[model samples]
Target: MELDEFDLALIEQLRVDGRASFESLGTRVGLSRTAARARVQRFFDSGVLRVAAMVHPEFEGIHAFGHVSITVHGRASAQVAASVAQLPDTPFVSVVSGRHSVVAELRSPDVAHLSDTVSLIRSLDGVQSVDTLILTHLLKEPHIPAHGPGRPEQFDETDRRLLNLLHEDGRMPYADLADGVGLSRGATRTRVLRLLGTGVVSVTGMVNPTALGMTQMSGFQLHLETDGTTALSVIGRLEQVSFLARTLGRCDAIGTLITRARTETVDLLDRMRAIDGVRDVQSWTHLELVKEQYDRRPLRANGAAHGAAASR
Candidate 1:
């Protein structure tokens, strides 16, 4: 579906606040509430946009986040990627070019669970080797800031229920959310606003690159010879980059970039290589994106309750 200027404006607003009311969205986009609602529904039906709530894993008691690079045997990269995507705790999976056949992001409750998940991947047919880099720091994430150590916020049953509903539909009407959580509309609004203010929950639109005319996607592993800080500063401002992080393993920094064509991707990489601090760069074009979920896991109360109750 082709997006007009109004559609782009609406999408930008949703990216900032997915929970915006149709009336509010209409005001921002110079359309009537009914018109705005219809357009948004069309975008959803056409698979152009997805509105969802993403909870911070650290706050949800998930301590281990890993990026796994898998080298498969022979020419079964697609098959290996499919198997990896189906593996438990694997959220993001892609068949990439270069040394690794597949790259996946795994989230686990703890180190033991991460180890178990890695072992399961190794046991998959046609898998040659697996290298994992523990994600120690997140420099940036979609609609959220970098994660840091902070006290886990406490939430009661009512709060959990509210979060669960939001997770299902970030743009769910406040009236519907109130009814679902058994609270007055005003109270529900206050609670949701408070949760957002505290960074316990985030609601935003997750746009698919291909749907937005970005047909080429690639991952880069960069090693810097000059000041790491200066290089990160330069790369972070690049509009083509979607994901960037300071890694602790073999690569100094890792990132994902999206472009409209192979030629454009190559040009973008050349610009990256020309940066003063970049020493070595390994680029991998994504042949197929197997699976990607921003809201991969749910948030739950800590301790004994744990899996018994999930907020997303």
Candidate 2:
């Protein structure tokens, strides 16, 4: 998407606090609430935004995966990409134009699932080679750092507080949240609607993997012949997978997932590896996740916006 100053501004606003209201956003951007809503809707309809809830695997149950760099043997990278993406354990695929080009995230129930995912990869149509590694600790999953080169502007205190409330529970009602956060319900409702409309703070239905009967936690990195981040959605629907993303650097894509299938082991792995582009992998058995965040919002340090919106 062609990102202009206004689009960048919108993104910055969301980065500060995903749950900012339409009225609140309008106030910040010098537009009316209706205009702000229209602008956000346009961006969304144009495929310029993506908002998802990413959960920690170990936080919910027993799940694991392997990460590897794979090198696809032929130009049919897309076919291979599609094949690997079809695996139940894989929730994301990236076809890149470098060494170890096809990076993928594989989900599994246990070590067996890990082995199976590998076997599946080895058996794919265009796959030439596969390497495997297990994850020890997740230093960081996917995160947006505030101190990055082009990080968003410093959020005022009010933005921070508003974010804090939503991170606690994205689904919290505006009326109830208004009382908790010291805001009028109408204003709170407007603010939250803006947040959602702007591709921020996506309130979604989430289920604990363990609670759902999955019994393991893990991760993987894949290497492939071709590279790109267009296959994330295709991979996200994998049976037990939860989160899938097209990363900027490092691995082409990644997925955090859960599972409980036994016999679908080696065959699955072979099929994945054998796919056109996959060549290698490394798996990390997630022992624990120190921190997990889905854009926890933070108002401006001075709470200026929150107070202003509330008073209005």
Candidate 3:
């Protein structure tokens, strides 16, 4: 569905605070409570918006995460991309136009598990080679919850069940959640509030860029001439930058940007180069998004390879 100014404003408000009361949201976006609720419900029903909990990997005991770029043989890019996208460990996958035909984001509990999953991707038919950039730190993630200082040491299996259910549907009512997890509604609400207060997971509305008319998306790898402190601060403020991370790889950092047109991308690249301490920047435009959901099941069941054979 096409999003007008009011719809976009409502969505933006939801992004900031998904659990905001309908009355509060209506006041923020110049709509009545009933109108705001109707707009949001319509978006959810039409699949234009999703409000879900995005967990912070480090807070969840996830240690290995990286970006894997795969090059494929002639006429095999689509098939290979589909195969890679199906793997449980690869949460985000997209076909792009550049040296690499497909790129996938890998997340695992440890390096060994990540290596096995990468090896499985390499073994896919028509796949040629894969290059990986191990992420060191997430410098800026507007969508994810801010990484809190402590991991929830008291986290248990019941917590996992609650988190998994929230990851699927963040707005699930306390009554339904309690029924699903066999807890009293009051207890379920208490635990959920704790999770949110601790920054373990954030339930926010994730907008589909295409529906908002910002269709062009690109990924960039940057080489830094310095420690990247200044670069990170400057780049993080740009509205176009949705995700940014420091990495241990050929490039010092990588980021994903969404723009309205190809020319805007070129303009953004020029701006990035002008930032002090940025030595070089390379980018690739996304051709198609094969998979974009954050699949937490793999990390939730740590040490289970899911058919990916161990690789040294």
Candidate 4:
């Protein structure tokens, strides 16, 4: 859909504060509280937005995906895609239009669980290969910033406070947020820059594909020569990368998420392969997601980057 400027503005506000109130949202976007509320409802109903409980994987430190890749046979790709996508342990799935067939990311309780899950997927129909990318040290993982879309860039602490309040309860009052964070309406209002600034968090604009008349896009994993300096640099140059993080497992990066364009992801991967010290590129198109909570939480609470928008 060709989103209108107001729609984009409306989406932008929600992107900053998913739970942004109609009143406060109106204030930011120059609309009536009633009008703002209606727009938000429209976004949700249209699959353009969905607000739910998001748990930081790092907080519990349970079991995050450790770079597990599954490949299915020829036409079995569909069956393979469905089988793994439906796996109980699976969280993220993409049936890509690529070499690997189906690429999925699953989280388990422990390494043993991961082993068992992969074994199970391997045993599934049309299964030809499975690759495990164990997460040893998380440089980055599934994260959300202030305002981007579903995934946004890190906003300032001022903005983070707003997020923290919402994280606890998306329905919190802006007046309460302002008072709790020690700022007036206008001052706090000015800090929304964090939504567009730097930090660990990011936001993303989400729309239901079924409603939007499209299917999911594919993502490829690139193992680069270095961290923040190298591998990260490769990821930075990829235009198709909707999200990137320095993670702690098999593939130092993640975001095999549903993309708007498959060709973009592939083109980015190809560019990465040309970089020096770059090894091979493995692309996986997740088919189905028996369980996916990407629109969920940030990292650990205590471990949350100090002064983060979500901090206490």
TM-scores vs. true structure, each candidate = 0.90, 0.44, 0.88, 0.63
Candidate 1, overall lDDT? 0.79
> How far is 261's C-alpha from truth in model 1 (Å)?
0.6
C-alpha lDDT of residue 157 in model 1 = 67
Candidate 1's clash total is: 0
lDDT of 4 by residue, 1-312 (tens): 556677779876765555556798888888899988887778877776655333344332344455556666655665676666666556566565655666666666577877888888878867778877765544334243332222323334555566555466555555776787899866765553333343333333344544443455555555655453565655655534554544454655555434456675566667667777567666665555433545433433333422112211
Residue ranges of candidate 1 with Cα displaced over 4 Å? 143-150, 296-299, 303-312
Instruction: Show model 2 residue runs off by greater than 4 Å.
Output: 1-4, 59-65, 73-75, 98-101, 143-312
lDDT by residue for model 2 over 105-174, one digit each (tens)? 5555577877888898988888998766565433333332212211124323443455557656554567
Error (Å) of candidate 2 at residue 24 is 2.7
The candidates, ranked best first by TM-score, are 1, 3, 4, 2
Q: Is candidate 1 or candidate 4 better by TM-score?
A: 1
- Whichever of 1 and 3 has more lDDT, that candidate is 3
lDDT of 4 at 108: 62
**Stretches of candidate 4 exceeding 4 Å from the true structure:** 59-61, 73-75, 137-216, 228-239, 245-254, 257-267, 270-312
CA lDDT, every prediction? Answer: 0.79, 0.52, 0.81, 0.56
The candidate that achieves the highest TM-score relative to the unseen native structure: 1
